[model samples]
Every structure is written in C-alpha cells, then in structure tokens.
Target: MASRKRPALARLTNALATPSQLQVSQALGLSGSLLSSLHYLGGSLIQVAGAILNIPAPTIATSAIIFHRFHLVAGFLEQSIRDTVAACLYIASKSCEFPLRPSVILAAVDTACQDPLAVGGKRIPKRKYTRANTETLDHWELRILTTLAFNLHVVTPYTLCMEYLVSANVDRDRQKTVAQRAWNYLNDTLKTKICILHQPNVIAVTAIWLAAREAELELLDGEKWWEAFDVDTEDMGHLVLLLREGRDIAIRERDRIESGRKPTLTVEDVKARILEEASLSSRQ
Candidate 1:
C-alpha cells in the first residue's frame, strides 16, 4: 500500500513551490508582509464565499488550495485576486462534484467582496453581474484551468485525518475534543503556505500530533504512532514548527491591526492600486 502511494506523492512534489518560485510575488514588488496579507485575504474570501454558497468544507479547502497554487505559478499581478477566488471556487465546486452555476458563484463572490470597514467606515460597493463581469469571470476561469493544466484533483487531508482519529487509541470522551482541535488546526493551516509545502498525509499527521499532544492523549504506538501511516518523524516535527510559526504570525498581525498600528487594506483598495499601477505601466 505504501509503495503504491509513493508514486502519487512523488507527483505531488511537482506542485510544491521551489525557493525561486516562492520569490515570484516578491519579485513582482509585493513586500513580505503584503504577500502574507494577500494570502490571508484569499483564504478569508474563500471561506466567506463558500459559506454564502453553502459549499462543504472539503470543497472550500480545495478552492483555497487552488488559489494558492495559482498565485504561486502566476503572481498576484497577473490576475485580480478577487476574480481568481471566484474562479477557483467555481472550479473546485465542480471538481468536488458539488457544482454551482456561474451566476450563483458571481453573486456569492460579489457579496463577499464588500468591506464594511472601508475608508470612513463606508461599505464598499458590491460589483454588479453585468455582461462584462461575466466575461471577466470566464476569462479568469480559463486562465486558472490552463495555468493548473486542468489538473484539479485536489487530495485534501480531512478524510485521512478523521480516519487516523478513528484508529487512534484515545478515550471515547476525549476523542471529540482531539478531533475537533485537529480539524481546526487543519483549517488554520489553509491560511498559510503549509498546504502547498507538505503532502496531505503529512499535514494530517501533524495536525493529529499537535491535537493529541495538547490533549495529553497518546496514540496506539505512542512515539512510533506516525510510522504506521508511513510518515517521517522529521517531516512531522518540521510541520508542527511551521504550523506554530504561521499561527504566531497571524496573532501578531491581528494584534497590530487591532492596535491601529497598521491599517487594513480592503479588496477595493488593492484593486484600485493594481489598476493604477497598470495604467502607469501602459503609459510608460
């Protein structure tokens, strides 16, 4: 079973971003902080849009993963992030067999794009679903499809994580708590680049590891529990560290924003900036 799975894992490595590939956004003039904010914004948009459409969690996760992969290959400058979110959710909804109509997706995304805390606390205007808007979405959908080579078979860790929890030797009473925490960890990881950095199974194991440790619950084999799933100890440890770092960064950003030390950038602000930059470039 492990040997057979190795080939799929090997293929997934192709999707992983190399160091130079990670620098694509930076090269495109996005600072490290801004890049992280963009990632957070994309994930938030996916979650909110999915909720509005009543999409399932797995499909929502797939959408966020698609968004991350798209940005890695084609930097944020190449496409409007809001449009890409709509396109990715549409693609993932179909790929996950929970198809939504393009019009429905556009409505949900348009609603999700509004920011109530914009300049002077005014609500950002929601985009109308005009013919031109539909064309823009169609263009973005094609771009995402072509950029990802139409390979939308995303393998998320939700199922495997749940399966591992069922197999774990935790007490019945504490099982729910551990599972919920692990699931939350998995969701949190989606906000960061860790999803693209590690394989699904590795991520599942890391979440389980973190949850179990927090609950003071040991698995069947204790120290070697992950071996049953063919996970490397070092990789799991590294993932745990990455997860913590991602969480810490998020907390710091939240604190900074709350303290009014940093102003929050709305979708409208980003779109306007991108358009202004493009106009300047075209004139040059």
Candidate 2:
C-alpha cells in the first residue's frame, strides 16, 4: 500500500486529471495553452492585490499560497472565481500584516479579473460587487479559512533570491531592478504547477535566472550561477522552462485579446458553461 502521503501527492501531481479539472477542461474546451492562460490570470489577481493594498512581496506570496490551496481543496465547486481570489487576498492581507477592507479587496478583484479587450467598455461582472457584498465576502473569507484549516504558514523565496543576488556581486542599484523582476517571477510561478513540484529555493534561483536573462543582466559568467546554491542545475533549468511557458501563455493571452479574435470569458462564465455541459451530458 502507498504511504499516507503518497495518495495526497498523487492527487496533487495529477491535479488537472481530477474531476474538477475535467469539468473545467470540458466546459472551457480548454486547449493546453488556454489552461496555462488561466493560471496566468490567477497570478494577475495577486499582482493587483499587491498593487492596490501596497503589500510586501511576502504578502503577495501568501496570497498565492491561499489561492493555490483553495483550488487544491475546493476546486471549482466552492465559490465564484473572483470571490475566491478576493477571499484569498483578504486572508493573505491579514496573515501578511497588510490588512485591507473587504471593499478594497473587491475593487482589486474587479480590476484583476477585467478583460483587457473590454478596456473601452464597461466591464461585465457576473454580478456587481458593492459595499453591500461585504457580508458575502465575509462568508467567503470564512470558507477559505475553513478549507485551509487556518494553516497559513508560507515560506516564500523572496529572501533567498535576495541572498543569491548579493552573493553574485550584483551592484546595489541593478540588484534592486533584478530583485524586483525576480520577485515578479516568483509571484508568476504561483500560477503554475511548479510551486507544488519544486522547492522554494530552487524556484527562487530560477526566478533570478529568468529575470537576469530577460533584463540581459549577466550575473554570472557561464553556468557559475548555480555554484552557490545547493540545487541541481538541470532541475532549476526545468523550473525556468515552466516559468517561461507561463510567461509565454500570458503574452499570447494578451495578444489574442488585443486582436479581438474571441470574447473574453470570466471564471463565472467558464463555470456556468461547465455546469451547463455537465447537465446536458447527463441527459445523453
């Protein structure tokens, strides 16, 4: 028999093959690329939450932790996507010591979930969220807390990335730039399965590598960048590829939205479509 941890690991490893994943795939008619795009969309929610609340990088990390945990547990059956994202931010804000009003979190959620293609027009939320929705948001926060069992301990790679940059002899001024970009990459990684698959330090180093590459900052000569960290170069390299793929997905999502090739669908739309399809399939 598999150890107790094995089954849980198996479920998470094949996360997208689970019932919730299948429902989403069938509902969205999800291409692999579109699936990647959804993860990117989730990352954007964290970014918006951070910007609006002026939370630190660790708070952003906390938000991702909450976001991923909610999906891992409740999947698509629990709440509307925006509400879930907002609830995650709410919990993260408190946990990370950047408490925000429910209204502020909701506003950020609205901005995060906005379809860029609808820039010139009014956003079509599945429903409008006003201050009156505070009660509903309170309920959502409770649900997320219950689902996560209130275990909010998250050790993000933010600090590890800093140590790597300093050890690499990156100058103070450019270190800020490199660190900021690496921080963004770290937040982005939460949108991918890499978070669950890789160690925090490995992801941390890989984010630095990706940031340095994008900025054309040569932090090391040859492959010496891996020298200081106790991580396998091949594994870190693979993590880099995962982050890069997500970056590409976000870029492509942007391009598609800009070209007006298709209407943008919110999480609600996706969920509704899934329920509709499931209902129809049952009759057939």
Candidate 3:
C-alpha cells in the first residue's frame, strides 16, 4: 500500500513551482506575488462553490487544480476574460460531482470576484454575468473542454499517497506532519504546470521523496527508496531531478529580486510606476 509514501507525494504536489507557470507570468507580465494571489482567488472561489453546493473539500480542491491547469493552457488573460472564472467553476463543479448548472456557477463566480478584485492594487470590479456574459462563459467552457479533449479525470498524488501511508501504518503524529506538508506542496504545484508534465503516480512518488528530504525524515533504510513504493527507480529519480531544478531556479530568482540588483521591480513597485505613468498621462 506504500502507506509510508503519502507525505512526500502530497508535498511534491504543493511545493514546487513549474516552468509553465513561470512562462505564463512572463507572458502576462505578472510578478510572482500577483500570480500567487490569482491562484488564491481561484482556490477561494472553488471553496465558495463547495460551500454553496455541499461538495466535499477534497473533491473541490482536486477539481480546482485541474481547472487551474486548464486556465494556464487557455492563456491566463486579464479580467476581460470573465469566462475564466465561470468556465473553471463549471468544470470543477462537474468533476467534483457537485454538478452545478452553468448559470449557478456563473453567478457564484461573479459574486466571489466582487468586493476585492484587486490586481496590482487596482480594484478590478467584477462585471455582471448578463446574457452576453453567460454566452461567453458557455463558449469558453466549450473551448476548455475541447482543449482538454473532454478529459475530466484528474488523478493527483494525494489519493495514492494516502493509501500507501495508511497501509504502511506509520505513527499518527508523524503521518499528520508529513501529510500536511505534502498537502501544501500539492496546492502549490497547481499554480505551476507540473501536473500536465508527468503521470500523477510518478509525480506522487517524486513528491514523497522531496517531502522526506525537506523534513529530514529517513523513511527508507537504504539508497533504494523507489523499491519501498514499487516504483521505477529511474523514472522517480528523473522526476526528482526535475523538481530540484525547478526549486533552484525559483530560489535564484527570489534571491535576485530581494537583493534589489535586478532591473525589474516587485509587484508593488510596478503598481506605483504604473500609477505615476497614468497620472502623467492625465496631466498631459
């Protein structure tokens, strides 16, 4: 059952940022913080849907991650792409077995995005999901569906990892600590493009390796950790290597930004500059 492996797999899903997410950030000219907030917003909306529809939290989380992947594939555009929220909600609801009507999902998304739609410190008010809005969401939903080739099944590392953890019969306290870290990792991974890059099981195994390394938990007695989970050593090793590379890149970039040596500024700096430019334009 590989019960001992759950913690690492869950952590891997949440912790590592992916190349695809970086690309989207660059393409959209968003800083890391703003991008992270959007992820939070999306996740919050998913929670709101779950609350409204009485769906299980895990189901909503899984569906939200899948919807996030689809969002990146569809080009994470500005708020003009209102369909982004509704489409994701629609897909997430269905996948989570909540099965919200399109209109209901649209309304929920609209309500969630209001109050605080702050991007770059500028409040982008939520637009009404009128007839046009509904049509747009419907069309965008189709596009997302087609892009995904109608694939709705998303197998994340959490499920199998949990099974292994239970089967291994690890102590409750240790399991809880590892599972929490791994769960955080899984959530963080959704912000990046890692899910689409590898099979969920492979990613899960690699994640377990990472969680153990981070926590300094020696779950394996020997160098052959893959044998414990009956996974391919080479494949698992490769995924771990990729995850390490991703981590290094993120760290370097973070350090560069913090040192204030880079030409680019943080999101706040960018926002202030944008406002200054706008004020100058207004004066002219």
Candidate 4:
C-alpha cells in the first residue's frame, strides 16, 4: 500500500487501537505534529466548555471523554471530531438534570464556529450519533490514527516536577521553591523544541532541573538541594548536565540551518507530494 505522509496520525491510531497512545500521551507529551493536532481537539473542547459556561470539572471531563471517543472513532471533521465534540456536548446537556437536544448541540457548535448551517443546514443529513452510528464511526475513526502513530505523547515537564515534589518529603518553603523553579523551566520549554515531544519522565524532570541549575536558581534556601528529593544524588546531578547538552545541540542545529548545511524540504518535496496525490486520483 502507498504510505500516507502523516506518520504521526498513523502512529496515533495504532497506539489508540492498542491503548498505547494514552501511555505515550501521558509519558512523552506528544510530538510537535501531534500537538498540532491537539489544537483542534483542545479548541473544540474549550468551545463546548465555554458554551456551557463554567461547567463542573467532572462534567467537563465526561464531555471531553465523549468528544475524544468520537474523534477517535470518526477522525476530526464533519461527522468527525467537530461533530463528536458537538454531540458530546449535546449528550452531556441531556444527561445532565437539565435536558438538552441534538438541536441544542448543533446550535452551539454552529454559533461558536460561525458556521451557521451545521445545525440547520438543509443538505446535511441528520443521523443519530449512537450505537446505530457506531459502525460508520469505526470506519472513519482510524483515518488519522495510523498517520499519528510515530508521534505518541508522554509525560510533561509540569508532571515531572510534581512527581519530584511528591517524593521530596519537603516542607512548605521547599515546595514553593520547587514550583517556582519548575515554572521557570516550563516557561523556557515553550520557546524551544524541547516542548515538542515530551521525553521520558526522567528526561522531563532533568530538563527542568537542568534549566534551574543554569539559571542558578537556588532551591530550598540553597542548602537543601541535595536533601530535597530522595533521588539518587548522582542521577540528579545528571539533570544539570542535560541542560548543557540540550543547549549545545540546539546551537549546533541552529548553526547548521543558518548556514544552509541542514537540508531543506524544498520545491521538489512539494512537487513529489503533488504527483503522489495525482497518482492516487488516477488509480481511483
């Protein structure tokens, strides 16, 4: 079979099929590309939440799960993630003590996206997004899953810091230090490639720890660094080293790109992609 260019989508689908994607999402953060995919999911989540207006966290979670399941089943488009999110919100409303309708969900989705016809469109067929639609959903659900398999997510920097905090047996003062120090590292991550795919939890923590070290941000009154976490002191020490290594790699990559030594995906890349698409059409 001709392969799709969207490796991350494929990877994600495979992982989801086996429950491996959840492990990756929690452990690695997610690849740059997969995170890009999440923007749509997240945005849709937020949009639904906003329409509900300050929904309880549990209800929000329930609705999000529904949306996610739907997205996984049907991919993320019409009768897809967008539809799933809308349907989930619709379900949540009805399931709540207060009744909601399919029309209610469709309206909210239509209003939020400024695509008015989604709910009332004359041409769009109305199908019950229930067990009846399950078969159809399954058929389309795996579309992007395979494309995203290579880009499984993992534990994030924030979670790593929290883990360290829990194991540290630290007092209040030390807790403050850890939180602030961790924040610094997280903020830095947003500006760098390190924010892309989350590494192992150890890597995530080490990256933050290394950043803290470089900033010379003394933790827990400066004297308690060694005593904070019940971590192997030697292993902890390696965290500081990680920052330097990352910096070095970043600098080298930047230099290579600046000097045009790093190969660019160029006009040929686009041309080849276009021809590939054309060939597929011809076959069909």
Candidate 5:
C-alpha cells in the first residue's frame, strides 16, 4: 500500500478561520469548558508576564494573540503551555519593536508564574534559568515560528479604536470615559477567541459602539456611525454578544477568587483534570 499522507494544514492568517477548521484541541476531543479555561489561562499569563517585564500594552496584546494562534494550530497538550506563553512574549516583543533579551523574558515569566492569583491559587515553584531552560524556550520560539508560518505581523484594534473615537467627535467631557471603556473592551476580547474570529476594524467599531452606549454619548449626530465605517450591523451585534460573554466570564472568575473558592482553573490544573476525567470515562 502507498504511504498514507497527512491532511493539508489550514492556511494561517492574521484573522478569520472557518468553523470547519477545527482547532487542534477540538480535534483531540477536549471539552469546550476545558479549552476556554486554557485560553483564559494563557492570556492571563501573557498579561502578567508583560507587566513584570514592563513591556508595552501593544506588545502584550500581540503576544496574547500569538499565544492563542499557536494553540489553535498546535494543541496545548502537544507543547508546554507555560513555556509557550513565555516564548510568545519573547517573539512578540521583538516583532512589536520592543525587544527584550531571552534571559529577561524568562525572568519575567518566572515571576508571573509564581503569582497565585494568576495560576488559580496554586503555588508554582520558581525554577532557576539553567542552560536547559534557555534551550527549552529557544525550541518553543522556533516551534511557534514554524507553526504560525512566520506570520508575525498582527494588527491590533487599539489604533483603529482611537481613530474611530476621534472621528466620532464625542463631547470633550465624556471623551476620556468613552475611550477608556472602548480600550478595556478590546483588552477583554483578547481573553476570548473573538480576536481571531473578527477583523481588528470590526472589533474596534464594536468596542466603540458599546462604549458610546454605556456613556450615553451619541456618535456622528445620532446617525448609524458604524455604517460609515462599512461595518455590518449584524457583525457588530454578534461581536457585542461575544464581548458580553467574555466580560461575564471575567467577572465570575474574579468573584470566585475573591470569595476564596478553590481558585479558577490553571492550565496545568485543567490538563490534569481532563486526563483524570478521560481515565474515569474509559473505565466506565
């Protein structure tokens, strides 16, 4: 018999993928809840790592996007998610023109990993940066590069969002409120798959839409401002709903932590739970 051939990989892009193009985790029979938890965990790690490294927000956002895209192509089970998080930050920092040394990136990741709140209240022991650790990160960095096919140019929603706000010409008094809310919405979307699903322009418009409604500020003299941007009304509505769901998840996670519950699921915790559940199911 002729040797079996592997399935063709999906063409990678900065945004958009068809529903038929299942993520690697989905292909592995992972539950939706487990995948969501992992996505949130990775994003949180990127945020904390960025803060510890004093990297800029744009670079942090790019890192989160790269992290998600990498997992979408190569499942969390295939690679160490924590190490990938550090590697993504390292690659994004360079791509975003905010380069940091690998040693510095590793240090920041170590500190971020030690945060109990970020890691679902688990006390992760700090690991010293040995030659082995450096080699591991270098390997992950190359994996990300090849998995993503060197598509590192990520266009974020922040600049588009600011432009839309300026074009809308909101009242000077409420301008800051609207801008801040819109920015927060953009950041929250990073935690979910919304970033990969919609184009940056669409996401930016939707963010402004929600922010204006909350501030009770009308844009473009109460006309259909989104129409001017050529944004579909239906897409805006869909993004709004997605953003709401992400916000709810964030709030619940926060409350759970504050209430002193067992803490939200970390990537490692979720992986272990999934394996245990699979074992139990197999026995049954």
Candidate 6:
C-alpha cells in the first residue's frame, strides 16, 4: 500500500507523468485541471482499469493500458472521478455478462462512438462513425500509454482483492462475477488513494463484505449473490472490520454529497463516525 503520498514512491509518480518522451498533454491538449477533474469526476477510468484485467485472453491490454496512461496525463476532481468509476464498472459488467469478448467491447464502443468500426485500421465494420472518431480513439490510446510509461501490471482493486483472497486461501475463483461485483465497490473508494497508501488489504476486504451485504449475497437475504462461494474466516474478519468502518465513510460521503458539503474523511473523522454507527447499531 505504498501510496503516492509516500516520498519513496515519488519516482513512480514522476514516471507516471512522463507518458513517453512525447508528453501526452502536448499531443492530446490535456490540461492538469482537466486531467485531475476527470479522475475526480470519473470513476469510469478505475472501472475501466478493473474491466481491463478481466478482458479475457487473446485480447490485447492496449485499451486498458492506454486508459491508465491517460490518468497520469489527466487527473479529475472528486465528483466527476466517482461518476467515471461508475461508468467503468458498468462497462466491465457489460463486457463480462456477455462472453468476455474484445469484439463485444469494440461493438459497444462503436455504438457509443457513432463511428464506423475499423478492421485492421481500414475496413469500416460499422457505418455509423467517421474516420475522425476512430482516429481519435486510436490516437488517444497512444498518448495514454505514454503517461503510464508502458507499465501495464499495476495493482487494481479487482486484482488486489483477488490476490488477497488467494493468499488467504479464500476460494471463490470459479465464481468470478460474484467476486468482481464485490471488488468493484471497494475499488470505487480507492479514488481517494487513502487506502492505497495504507491498510489497503483491510479496505479491500471490507468492501467485499459490504458489497455482499448491500447486494444481499450473504447472511439473511443478504447472502444471495455470493452463497455459491466460500470466504475464509480470516478474510471475512478483516473484511468485516474494514466494512464496518467503511459504512461510516460511505454514509458521511453520501450525506455530504447530498447536502452540498465537501467530502473529507480524516482519520479521526472516520473513527468518530464508526463509533457513532456502533452506538446506533447497538441500540437497534
């Protein structure tokens, strides 16, 4: 969980921004504010990143890699960042619900783009889009990889949870969609980069459990979506602790977002919120 907040990771940060010897902003005209705001407002990027990992075999990692590279080139504000995450998760789910096919992603992208689809960069598979639209996507992907410095193996919430589950011997690999849905929710919060800097494993598990409860895949009617799998006791306990804490963070975030308040979760703020929930839950 060594975060960008850590001085030691400064080099990684620098590399993240490099984006080739070419500088992505120079070509894409992406400004710092636009980039930052995109990350803030667009959770889709993270969702896209998550979806990329599950892109199925034989599909190139190009799109996912490019999207991530774009991040370093452009980070967004908080609200937009969250929305983008939602879009990204939605995309992954769509991709998976189908056959995990690249053609599916392209067809989906094609429908969204209103542009003619390309086959080997020439033949138009779809008749809706202009060459400009197709070219833009292609060009942007190049610059995105530039920002990432070609690093395609970064740890994501999807991968992170999977790794954690496997190491803990929590066997749910065969039931991927169930695990993924859980991971996606947790990954949403990482936009703040707080958990990524510290105690990320705890955060990841907490999200898994919380998603389970929210989705009703666990205890009570709460266990519908994920009963086909088993979670290790150690993983479940850690997940419970983190999720108990996360529920507060999530509530405060929801309230603040609704009330037009700023979303901030300092350590003490989180602790106090959790204590408040504890009292309320105890009474109930």
Question: Which candidate leads in TM-score?
Answer: 5
Deviation from truth (RMSD, Å), model 5: 6.4
Please give the lDDT score at residue 188 for candidate 2.
74
Backbone clashes under 3 angstroms, per model = 0, 0, 15, 32, 0, 41
What is candidate 1's lDDT per residue for 157-186, written digit by digit as tens?
A: 888898888888677778899999999899
- For model 1, the superposed segments whose C-alpha errors exceed 4 Å read 1-14, 115-128, 256-265, 269-284
Query: How accurate locally, in lDDT, is each candidate?
Result: 0.75, 0.66, 0.55, 0.40, 0.75, 0.38
| Candidate 6 minimal-lDDT segment of 10 residues | 115-124
Better of 2 and 6 by lDDT: 2
lDDT of 2 by residue, 1-284 (tens): 01112342332221122345334444533345544545555656666656655667778776776676566556554357777778888888888777887777787677666652221233323445576699878898898888766766566777778888898898888888989998878877877756645656678888888788887888767566665665678878788788889767666656766798654345655566546555665676
TM-scores of the models, in the given order?
Answer: 0.81, 0.74, 0.57, 0.33, 0.86, 0.37
Residues 1-284, candidate 3, lDDT per residue (tens digit)? 01123565553433222566447544555454544444444554454544455555466656566566665555444332235556766776766666776666666555554421221222223445467767887787788778656766556677866765565465788777777776656644543445555556666666666666677776645676656665677766665554554444446545765697662222233345434544554576
Candidate 1 residue 107 C-alpha distance from true site, Å: 2.7
* Candidate 6: segments with Cα more than 4 A from true spot: 1-37, 45-69, 73-127, 159-184, 190-284
Better of 3 and 4 by TM-score: 3
TM-score-wise, the better of 4 and 5 is 5
List ranges where model 4 is wrong by over 4 Å: 1-42, 45-52, 93-101, 115-284
Candidate 5 versus the native: TM-score?
0.86
Runs off by more than 4 Å, candidate 3:
1-58, 61-65, 68-82, 101-104, 107-129, 230-284
Q: RMSD of candidate 3 to the true fold? A: 9.5
* Candidate 4 C-alpha lDDT tens digits along 1-284: 11222343233211122244334332332333332234333333333433444444334433543344333433322333444455555455445544455544444454444321111222222434555444433343343334433232322345556666555455666566656766555533322222222222433455445545655555455554543333344654554443444444345535666797842112233234334544554576
Native-structure RMSD, model 6: 14.9
Query: Which has the higher lDDT value, candidate number 2 or candidate number 3?
Result: 2
lDDT of 1: 0.75
- For residue 250, model 3's alpha carbon misses the true position, in angstroms, by 11
Give the least accurate 10-residue stretch of model 2, judged by summed lDDT: 8-17
